[model samples]
Target: MSFSSVPFFITFAENPELAICAEDSIKGARLVLKPFKNNLLALFNVDFVQGLFGLATSGNQLVIGAEDITLGAPLALQLLQPESGKLQRWDIFSAPGNIVSAADSCLAFGYRLRTKPPLQLTELNAPPFPQWIFLPFTTTQRGILESAV
Candidate 1:
């Protein structure tokens, strides 16, 4: 089976020595393994106090929003595919006190105040990945989203 068919986790070490070791090992394995490490798993946690609010995706990217009781505003996370020429490591962006919502090809995010003007949603164009080509359309319109790659 290919690496894409398997489940794995990616981690980064903060210590300089550990970081260097991890990088070197990954590089060595990639050199010998050919196209290994070409996929990544994106994991999200929903604390007991925080409940899931929304989910949105653009291409290989995903944004998850949650309502945490401790915070005044919702929390959002943006996950993106790793850049080419590197081990398949994903990127994550976290936003606290941000109102995030999504619909169709649009994504709305930012802070808002009571009685203030509403913020506009940002239009997200199709990404380069084929898996996200039909993301803007409904399941009924585009059929089931599946991949055999």
Candidate 2:
């Protein structure tokens, strides 16, 4: 999938050589992985049951996260080893909007105000390596200074 197509996530900090994108096809959601720095490699696509909403990488392990509005908190997350063909699964309590790798084997992410902490990224021990996810912040509070003549 093209960058302009659907939502795209890459491991820029952890592994600049690899990247991933969520491809929505006529059938269902697909995970597309390939080399970002080199174009000689072919695109690797895998069929995913849940919608891949977020992507983060730690070392060679790729942490895949999904969002389910129907199921309040997230139940689990997937860890895929591309070369080894091994996938690890873990459970989480809450849901996270966007997930990024944090220091000390932690994942940090922001969730809506009403949502509870989904073991999502709150766990202290998770992922072998992590990537950085960044989003712009905004404040709603406004102040106007009044001038006295």
Q: Alpha-carbon error at 69 in model 1, in Å?
A: 5.8
TM-score (C-alpha, index-matched) for candidate 2: 0.27
Q: How well does candidate 2 score on lDDT at residue 72?
A: 28
* 1-149: candidate 2 lDDT, tens digit per residue: 11112223333244544444333221223334334332211122222222222232222123344332222233233444333122222222222322432221233332222344322343332343233322111111122112323
Which window of ten consecutive residues has the lowest lDDT sum in model 1?
Answer: 14-23
TM-score of each: 0.17, 0.27
Question: Which candidate leads the pack in TM-score?
Answer: 2
Residue 96 error, candidate 1, Å: 26
lDDT of 1 by residue, 1-149 (tens): 01121111211111111100011122111100011122112212221122221111122233233222221223233332222211121112222222223222123222223422211222222221111111111212222223325
C-alpha lDDT of residue 15 in model 1: 17
Q: Model 2 off-target regions past 4 Å?
A: 1-9, 23-27, 37-125, 133-149
Q: What are the lDDT figures for the candidates, one per model?
A: 0.21, 0.29
